[model samples]
Every structure is written in structure tokens, then in C-alpha cells.
Target: MKIFNAEKIKELDKLTIEKQQITSLDLMERAALQAFLWLVNHFQDKKTVYHIFCGDGNNGGDGLVIARLLKQNYFDVHVYIVPFNENFSIVFNSNLGRLKECNLEYEVISEATEFPNIGENHIIIDAIFGIGLTRELAGWIQKLIQKINYHQSFKVSIDVPSGLFLDKKTTIAIHSDVVLTFQFPKLAFYLPDNENFIAEIVLLPIDLDVKSIESIPSTYYYTDLNKIKKRYKPISKFSHKGTQGHALLIGGCFGKIGAMVLASQAALRSGCGLATVFVPKCGYEIMQTATPEAMVITDENYHKITNIEFNFQPKAIGIGMGIGQDDETTQAFHHFLKTIPFRW
Candidate 1:
């Protein structure tokens, strides 16, 4: 799964609709259906009240469809549509027509003068804004989001948290406990700095065209089961000790031999056919005692490592494990880099 910027998402939407021949309406329906499927399967008991906050965009369209579906299931549902400009989205209007056909009650909050009283025990679905949102929240919508945050209800966002940037870090006033993003995981969701706003993220795959999506150039990636499983390979019976490559580890001083020990363990676990470790004279006993499997080489100095010498050919070199960065060590390391026919 490739991670994409906000601009690339628009290109993806265009590719899905234009090149792949998927209509915008179909995407909207499928998106709503997927969200509704989750709601039905997880919260079937109708144990909690549902309040959906919708803006005048496609995100709100999704909320309207969910509102209609939840009403059919006899779930206690309330929808608040924050109307923007003079006109609402066409798809949203279509969903509004359907919700009205079912005679479901919803409040059109056009202004902040009369705010809706929210209950803390209910679940709030934030559909006010999605990835298309660029600027900061303004006027009553900001207050509305603040009120939603203040309510302390379990909030779930569709696609993205309302007022959050899918790529860059935008200062958002609203936060969601869990954001159910569409398709790939957004970059902002993975950032440690964004953990509070995103909290926990769940990816909902909506079946975009594989070929066209691949053609779209993107460096960012969303690593998931599907992407990893597609390229996974299992070991074969014909494999042997020499089939895997040898790995060399350099770095261990008198007091910090444990660092090399941990690294060597990781190398062995990673299926290295052969492993070698270089340490100072005093740390040789420690490394040999801890890991008998590793071939050991002692440095020239007793208290610290000064030089690395080896005869056998190694496929990979793992360095800087416990290497000190003092002036002499730095010069030695620079010399080592120049001595080897390699780039550091």
C-alpha cells in the first residue's frame, strides 16, 4: 500500500473515476456501505446513542448514508448537518432525500446561536471534514468541533479526523479517539506527534484500481498485511548453511560488551549463516561466554577497540554498535572507512 500526499489522493480519486471507469457516486456508495458494515457488525445491540456531525461535503454525504442505515436498524440516531455557503453537495442532497423519505429527524445547524445539547454516553460520528479540508476551521464550525470534543463521547472520524491534515501537521482543534481512514493509512496517523489526535487508526479498504493506482507515482507507503503478504516468500527445503550470507559485527569495549551481544543475537535470529564479532581484549571473554556461536576477534587495545582485523569474507558488515565516538575513535573510524573499498 503506497502512502500518498493530499494532492496524490485527488489524483487517485480522479484515476478511479476517469481512467478506471468508477463513478464518483459509486465510490460514495461503497464508502458509506463499508462504514455501515462496520457499524452494524460491531455495535449491533444498539447499546449506545449515535450522533453524526456532517458538513456539506462528501464526508457529510457519508454521514447521511450512515444516518439512514442506522435508522433502519432501529438505532437511536441524530444527525447535525453544518451547512456551508448556500448550497450543499449533490450527493449529500441525495442522501438527505433518502433520510427524509425514511422520516428520520435531523438538525440543520446553520449557525452557532443555537447549539445542540450533547449527551456524554453516546457515540459521535465526526463527518464534518475529511482529507479535502485545507484551511483551518472557522466561525461556528470551530465551536461545533470544540463542543464535540468537550462532550467526551466516543468519537469516530470518517476518512480523517475533522480539521486534520492527511500529510502535513496542521494545528487542529478537534480530535478523535479512533479514526477509520479509507484505503491506505495516512502519514499523519503514523507520526508520534499526531498520536493524540489520531489516537488509534483502522484502515478500511474500498477496492481502488490496482494498475492505475500503481501508475500514479508515490514514494510514501502504507505497510499493511496486504502489501507485505503479497511479497512474502517462505524458506525452501533446498536451503543450507552456505545458502545464507555471513554477517560481521564490529563494536565492543570493556564495559559495553553487552551492546555487541544484543546485536549479534539479532543477526543470528535474522538467519545469518555465519556471524563474527570484534571486541577489545577484556571483552573477549564476555563475548565468547555469552555467544559461543559467533567467531571472535580481539582488538589491539585492552580497554577499548582500536582496530578491526579479519581474514574470512563477510557478506554484510554491521558497525557502530558499541563504538565510542571520542576523537581517537572517530579518526580510527574514518581511517577504517577509507581502508575498506566501501561507502560509509
Candidate 2:
């Protein structure tokens, strides 16, 4: 599925509104409804206490609606509005009044004086800052997220995590234990470095348009493994070892024969039909004892490589890990590189 940026998101939001013939409030309602539905499916109301923190944007509107719906369902819930600014958007104000009418446990923390103490056992619903957070959590709000992290409680971030940059705005993001994201996953949520930011997350579809969503452009993507699985081509049953390619690895100084062994091991594991390793004579016994599957050739010297007699055409050549920059070894490597020209 396609992920969007902050601008594209607004476009998609307006597109969804126009396409579905619903207002932005309707989108917020379904978003919160779906979030609450997920909560009901995963959690029971009999004894769970929920601490919901909301902002002044539509993200908080969703939180307020969740609070009201939970109350209507007779669940124990507390709503805390982390007041960044007093003037909330119209939908937020509307939901705020509705939550007030239900006499829900709601409080507005305008400053540090009104900050409420959250117990360690509580499930925190962080809506203080959602996907549109374009800047760093600055001043007192930065301190608030740090405090939230210190509590070490089971926290659930609504939409994207409270401080995530939705469309590559800022390079930073807040890590959430569980992110209940809407429609599609966030682009940052799938980054190799972002796994810590998002421990576990699930996409809650609220039905955005496919054509309009594709009309937008983005570089980052949420790599869905199931979708990738459909594109994987398995090995043909008639394939033979010779059909695979060979691999040549050059490395390993006097004492680091294990480097060449590891390279040969990886080459074999990656389905290389044949593998060869070139190292100093000091590593010959080591490689032979450790990995007998590899064919080995040694340079003339005992502890360093002066020259390498390259013969076989390998599909790939891997070099440099534990290879020391000795003069003779360096000369050999330079000669080898110039002898074998590669495109890229």
C-alpha cells in the first residue's frame, strides 16, 4: 500500500472527503471508531484503566471521540488534554464538548501546574503530538515526552507516534511501543533504524481511495512482506550447481584467517557454485582446517601477500574486512584492481 506525506495526506484527506462524500469530521469519527473497535477486540473493559493524552489537532479529536465512546460503553477511561495552545480546531472543540457532556474524566493541563501524575500500570494513549509534528518536541512539551518515556508504561500512540515526521519533514521521530496507525503505515515506521521507534504496529484501514492515493508521490515505503512474497520467484526445479555462479574472495592477513573463511561461507550460503579464497600462507592451514569446502591458494610470502595469481572468472569478488594495509599486500591489491576492471 502507498504511504503519504503531510501535504499529500491533506490532499488525500480532502480527496477522501470529496470522493466518499463525507466531511473531515466523518473521517475522524471512523478513524476513532476503528481504533476503539481494535481496542475492544484486543482488550477487555472490566478492569482496564486507560490514560488518554490528546493534542489540539484532529488527532486529539479522535482521542476525545475514543474517550466518549469508551464511556458510552461503560469503560474506565481518563482524558487529559496536553494544552499546547488554547485554540483547538473546530472538530476538536466539538468533540471536547461532547466528551464534557458525557461527564467523562477529562482535564485540561495548560501548564506544568496542571500536569497529572500517571501511574506506572496505566496504558497511556499519547495524542499530545501526532503525525503533523514538523519540529522537535521543544520547551516543556519535549520534557513531557521524556516524562512519558520515563514512566515505562505500556504506551499506545494514536495515528503515527506522537512526534513522528509524517512526510519526511524532520529526520527525527519518537519511538512508540505500539502505534495504532490509520489507513496505511507511516514511511518512517519501516526504516531499519526505526524499528526501535515502532516496536509493534498494525494498519487500521479507514477506507481511503486507491486511485487518489496513487496519484500522490513519495520516496519512502512501508515494505509489506506479504506483498513482496507475491513477487518472489523461487528456484526452478531443473537448476544445477554449475548454473549458479562462482565467487572469489581476497582477504585475511597473517592472524585473521577466519575472515576468509567467513567470506567463503557466505559465498557458499548465497548459492555460489564454486568458491576460492586467496590469503597469505600463514592462513592456508587455518582456512583448510576451518572450511574444507573452499579451494584455497596462498601468496608466496608466509605472513603477507606480495602477489595473487587470479584465474577463475567469479560472478562476484568480495574484499576487505580484516585485510591489513601492508605495503606488499597493498601493492598486490592495486595491481589486482587495475588488472580487473569493473563497470560499477
Candidate 3:
């Protein structure tokens, strides 16, 4: 899956709306429906109470739509509107109107004191903020997030955890057990800096325009089974050992022979036809004993790799597993790179 930044995601959304000839409201409904389906599928118990915290934005609109769907289906649902500011998105107000039409009541939390006590048995759906959040949250809203985080309830965030920025780092955000994001995975979700705020990220496809998604330029991608299957090649029945492929693993110093053994074993296990390891003299016996399936070549040096020599060319070479930074070893590696037939 192509991972897009915030601006690129907006661009993709705009392109999708234009190409599909659907109104933005229609798109929002699609997103809300997807999220609602996921919730219903996972939590089959209609008696379970769901407290949905929403903002005055499209993300909050998603929560409102979900609440309406749940209530209409006889599921117990409670909606809270957490307006970070007085301004409200047009679609949000539209969804709010729809909620009222269904005779479903909602509460607007104006202060931190108005925050309800979420029980551990209940489910909290966080829709207060999405990827568009650009500034750090503070004051009562931050306090509300902290209150939600303190609860042991199963928290599911919509699009992204509240207060999370897609293109930048944020100090405070909703720590969710699951994040049901729309269409593509956000780049911020994978950053180590934001790990504390995120858990299992579920991608909910809203049927955005595929042509537009592919047309958008992106350097990041989330590799899943589908991607792997697309690139996989089947082996022929007539194929032999030499027909597969040759892999060269070059590493291992004095006490790090285990590294080379594991590398060579992995090479063969990954369907490599031939596996070879080049190590120092000390590692020669250890590598041979541990990995009998691999072909081992030893360096002239005793404890380090000062020289690397191989006759036949390998289809791929993996180096620097456990190679130490000795002066001679470094110089030998440089020389070996210079002698390779291929350009770097």
C-alpha cells in the first residue's frame, strides 16, 4: 500500500471526489460506513455501551454517522461532541442534523469537568481529531485526552488517534488500542516517535479512486501479503540447484562466527540454490560444523578478514554481518569492492 503524506492524502481525496463524481458528503458517508462495519463485525454484543467522542470536523461526522447506525441497529450508543473551538465544519453540522433526525441525543462537553466517567467494560471511539491536526493540543482538550487515556476501556480511534499529526510530530495524542484509518496508511503511524500513541492500525478501504492513488507520487509504502504475492515468482518443476540462485554472505570476526552460520542457513531456507560464506581462519571450522550445507571460504588472516577471495560470481552478495573494523579488514574490504565486476 502506498503511504502518502498529509498533503498528498488530501490531494488523493480531492482527486477521488473529482474522478468518482461524488460529493464530499457522499465520500464522508462511505468512510463512516466502513468504520461502522468494522465496529459491528468486531463487537457483536449489542448491549455493550459505546461512548463516541467526536470533534466538530469530518472525523467527528464519521463518529456521528457511526453512532446513528449503531442506534438504528439497536446497539447502545452515546455520542459526545468535543468542540475544540467554536468553529464547526459544514459536514459535521449536516451529520449532527442527521443524528437529531433519528431522535438520537448527544452531549456537548464544554469543559473538562463535563467529561464523563468511561467504565472499563465500555468501548470508547475516539474521533476528536484526525490527520489534519497541525498544532499540539493543550488546556481542557488535552485534559480530556488524558482522562480518556486513563480509562482501561477498549479505545478505537477513527482515521488516526486524536491529536496526531500526519506530517509532523506531536507530544500529546490519544493512545488507542486500535486505529481504523481510511484507505491508505498514514506515514506518521509508523514513526518510532509516535509508537506510544498507536497500536494495531487497521486500514479501512473507502473505495477511493485507484487511478488517483497510483498517480500520486509517494516514496513510502506499507508492504502486505497482496504486494508480496504480486512480486512472487513460481519455481519450475524442472529447476535444479544451480537454476535457483547463488547467495554470498561475507562476515564474521573472532567470536561472531554464529552470525555467518545463521546468515548461510537463512540464505538456503529462503530458496537460494547455493550459499557461500567467507570468513576468517578462526571461523572456518565453526562455520563448517554449524552450517554443513554451506560452502565456506576462509581468509588468510587468523582472527580477522584481511583478504576475501571467491572464484565464481554470486547472484547476490550480503556483507558486514559481524565483520570487525580492523584496519587490515577495512582495507581488504575496500580492495574487494574495487575488484567486483559490477559497479556500485
Cα-lDDT of candidate 3: 0.90
- Show the lowest summed lDDT stretch of 10 residues, model 2: 166-175
Give per-residue CA lDDT, model 2, range 246-325, as digits (tens): 77788888888787888888888877778889888898988888888888988888887788777667788887746788
TM-scores for every candidate against the unseen true structure: 0.84, 0.76, 0.93
- What would the per-residue lDDT of candidate 3 be over residues 1-344, giving only the tens digit for each residue? 89888788788889889989998889999998999999999999888899999999888988998999998998888899998867899989999999999999999987735678678999999999877788777588888998899899999999999988887768888999999999998888889999989989999999989988878788998999988999989999999889999999999999988989888999999999999999999998898899988999988888999888888888999999899899999998999888786642
Who wins the lDDT comparison? 3
Q: Whose TM-score is greatest here?
A: 3
What value does the lDDT take at residue 246 in candidate 1? Answer: 88
Which is better, 1 or 3, measured by lDDT?
A: 3
115 Cα displacement, candidate 1 (Å): 5.5
* Candidate 1 pairs with clashing backbones: 3-220, 3-221
Backbone clash pairs for candidate 3 read none
